[model samples]
Target: MPKHPIAVELEAINRDGETQVVRDCGLPVQGYSVYLRAVEASGLALATWIADYDTIGPAYQLAERLSIALAIPLTVLVPEPLMPVQSGPAATTGVITMAN
Candidate 1:
């Protein structure tokens, strides 16, 4: 198999001081892809449901139902919020004064 640039190497020392090398198979995809691939590779059981970014209200409810039906774990990927950027001294100024 080809090597991945971002792959991490893990070594575990047993009681006899024996070292074991661990190989990672699913480190490339994100969100649903990760769960789906893991299931397909026999590393994990079937993924009944998955909640992608921006899943809210009804979407969450539906996922739960599917999870129960398929007897698989429900994966939810919460997205990060974006904050406004501040630039210059006026960025924090709530009010501006004009020269009279």
Candidate 2:
């Protein structure tokens, strides 16, 4: 599966003076990309960097839904969270690297 971009709020305040802390509530723009078929025939590529693997699965799931909901194709760059490796350190290495 693919990963979704995050929705982030860069500043503490907008022109309105109040800033929206969407850290948990939303994702950063770089975290996800929205591709409209009508706009681009090939569609947009999924993002490779993500906030965490924890949300990778959900991001892909959302992409699938968006594809159907918006009638456009969406791809998530990150793969779904995998089961813990029984090998301990060896398996954890990849997870840690990707997280970074």
Candidate 3:
């Protein structure tokens, strides 16, 4: 069966986020990718991104690219939310909360 990218990617996100990593078959990959495909109520894919991995360089780059691709802003929140607020796109607008 040819697994849809959205389904495969969503499984990876749910697994990794809950377990903090994907573990199965004893030889699990060290890191996983969160491929987000946001679609509207009309079944149109609005945006997508491979987010929040150990190698943030790729994710970060993808965020930037996806922002342009989707015409929607991308944002990231630091772990230390209490830190002094520095003005930035991710810091100010486009609030996204992850459950993990």
Candidate 4:
């Protein structure tokens, strides 16, 4: 199956002492292009970088290595599935409905 796009966010400080959060979204191999652009433009000093994805995979590993090498804090954000809701009739009738 094809992998989902991952989002990388960086909290950085610029030359003016202003702080901002920059983000890039793409496949793992593409790297963090948007954040790099911000770095080149503003000379940002990274405070922390966050990797948000659905699963623990290549993107997570890459972020961890980059954090270690750059000596920046890394935060991983993974989503949890929502629990199914039980309603009056549906709960007792033993019937299920799925949407397409």
Candidate 5:
């Protein structure tokens, strides 16, 4: 059987202009994982859930709760399947943004 785990990450940029993962909160079976990060440059926390389409709602909820608790903005990134582009410009990856 496949496992659906949520991975949490807290990242920031150092003075050298390199992005670093300051904390890896590990994978949890379910529920949300929240972390406090600095408000400076490139300081943010992220939770990535890889699961079936049915779990998208829960993922959004998790992100929403984290955003509200941290008083920060939230952005959901959903990867789209690669397909043949028939015309004009290819479709760009879509994103959902929410502010708290």
Candidate 6:
């Protein structure tokens, strides 16, 4: 796998403990603030969410209600679905078997 340029820069800065430089360079793509801002902009009004499954319609209604009540732009925040972690020896291989 090819090393990404941004990764290389980050690694170098990390090695040197360049805290200031790291802050200046900004957060990595998957940063929490980025996700929060994106969700809020989309009209979801959560700073974060509880770790539980949710039904969408009620959440959207609440978001809309709150937005109107507070006269602020925001939306309901919901937890992302869990992504299964790949591990063990089988992880190295990409094939997935579907039981019939």
- Cα lDDT tens digits, model 4, 38-68, are 1323444332334433333444455545545
> Which candidate leads in TM-score?
3
Q: Model 4 — TM-score against the truth? A: 0.29
What lDDT is reached at residue 60 by model 1?
Answer: 38
Which lDDT tens digits does candidate 5 get at residues 28-55?
1222223333332344443443222223
Residue pairs in candidate 5 whose N, alpha carbon or C atoms collide under 3 angstroms: none
lDDT (10s digit) by residue, model 3, range 1-100? 2222221121122323442323233333333354555556556654334455644345445544554555554443222221233456643433343223
Clashes of each: 0, 13, 0, 0, 0, 7
lDDT of each: 0.29, 0.30, 0.38, 0.32, 0.33, 0.27
Clashing pairs in 1: none
Candidate No. with top lDDT: 3
lDDT of 6: 0.27
What TM-score against the true fold does each predicted structure earn?
0.28, 0.27, 0.35, 0.29, 0.30, 0.25
Name the lDDT value of residue 33 in candidate 3.
Answer: 51
* TM-score: model 5 vs. ground truth: 0.30
lDDT of 1 by residue, 1-100 (tens): 2221211111222234333221232222222211221233434334221333222334434444444444445443322121123366633333211111
Residue-level lDDT of model 2, residues 1-100, one tens digit each, is: 3333322111112224333222332233223222322322345543332222223334444444544454433432221232122353422221121110
Mark the 10 consecutive residues where model 1 has the least summed lDDT.
3-12
